[model samples]
Target: MDDITRDLVTLRDYWRYAISRFNKADLSYGHGTSTAGDDAAFLLLDSLDLPIDALDPFLDARLLPSERKLLAERIETRVTTRKPSAYLTGRSYIQGVRFHVDERVIVPRSHIGEILFREYLGELGSSFLPDPMAVESAVDICTGSGCLAVLAAKFFPQAEVDAVDLSGDALEVAKLNLAEHEVEQQVSLHEGDLFAPLAGRTYDLIITNPPYVDHEALDGYPPEYRAEPRLAHDGGVDGLDLVRRILDEAAAHLNPGGGMICEIGSGREILEEEYPHLDFVWLETASSQDAVFWLSAEALGVE
Candidate 1:
């Protein structure tokens, strides 16, 4: 080991080194972290088997020689491979719940997670779906990694969740997570295109974070993003290919007074323009102001 690496005996020292290396490498952040320091902390803390959140307590803790070597190797891989930290660690958390992740699925980083945990889906969510607790059945379409489906189960304890994804590989990862979260009984995994396997099964709430990345945007995504399954990110030419289909078909699958919550990233304006007749209530989260939308069955004109 080099002198600097050898000197990184304490967690604090290694954390500093990780941050410096991550910044110097110009790594893209979007998987689970938005900054180099946060990524470094995740890698460092996870490598040492320390709690990611309780960093202050373990900051001064010193690492053994073996531990330092493993950590150094992980940092080196992160800088050189441009892989997402989640892939490096083989674990990811959404709303404090842990899930297994790999190249088979995209990292769970949806704003809907925040809405589910908060139990209040912003003003628009409240107005569209007044009582989330009353939802008896929920469906999560395009359920990559099943993180959102698991969260929906936890949020709506009274509801049964159906997580649908087309990719068998992606569904396998979701299965692992659903089993890990012990929601297999409540969250059913389906392998089929959106709403195909869900035929004749109506839901009180439908939520999806479908692929909304336009062709141009998909091309611009960093290597870390490209590492994930293309089906999870490609939304066709306008990024609304799936969104358009969902809007047309979702109404038939929603029960009376039911609502749908969908995340479209930056397709809000396009959605409004495409369907000028329908009213979409844009919901805001801590990080985004107009990435997700809420629409009641009535608003969607479901019979």
Candidate 2:
């Protein structure tokens, strides 16, 4: 608590100091947008007495003495413990959409957010397959916190979204995120491995950010990996375990002319070498990730 005014001011000042120290650590092997310091501040702010929306306004105002101290404690706990700020706060954001997350699901950081939110995908004017009246239905296979599924629904309001995951806990978190956006009724949460719950259903688009880290890469990952679910990080020996499986099975679930897109991590080169027989287009994003690829049902040899 602050000595003069309130606890909020004290917390904010303390977090700013803690974040500086955390970011100085080595984080070369992990893929996270916010520095440790940035995360620490977020954690501190989340532990406050005010409404979540008050964060921006509070930062704009001068801090009171008491608010400073409480924030310091929050920062110290997170920085010293080496936990993610998203886990500490139970929330994370991608493309300005807030998601409820926990240890059950990896933090949402899909580069697909750039494409989906920015509407870089093809126009729906010519789309009439799923239904002439229906815009475009989508499947978020390997959906973790269901961030991409929600994004799909937002971008394609006329279409419904189905979010499928193997982890029940992760789906629970995903359900909350879908509901938070008032699209819970629109999104169907299915529990099963990728494309398993999908069965004979077809979609205009299938998206995934499946586990694609090679065993060696996982072994050498920075300390940040220790905080995330290993199931979401380890992609087997060559990192193509899940990617290959997805590519092989996804074609069966896509409508004719429909495609599947996945974030393949560093396995892009290996995939190219392994699947020279297939035709796929690897999409480039402003996020600078190179492994995202899309394959049509016909190109992948699926009926």
Question: How close is every model to the real structure, measured as TM-score?
Answer: 0.94, 0.83
Q: Ten consecutive residues with minimal summed lDDT in candidate 2?
A: 125-134
Off by over 4 Å in 1: 2-5, 120-127
**Distance (Å) between predicted and true CA of 54, model 1?**
2.9
Please, what are the lDDT tens digits per residue for candidate 1 over residues 1-303?
A: 567667788988888988899888899998778899889888888767677777889889888888888888899999899999889888988766788999999999888888765656445454455476798999999999999998888778899999999999999999898888889899999999999998899999999999999999888888888888889999999899999999999988999888898999898888888899888988888888999988988898876
Clashing pairs in 1: none
The RMSD of every model to the true structure, in order and in angstroms, is: 2.1, 4.1
Q: What 10-residue stretch in candidate 1 is worst by lDDT? A: 121-130
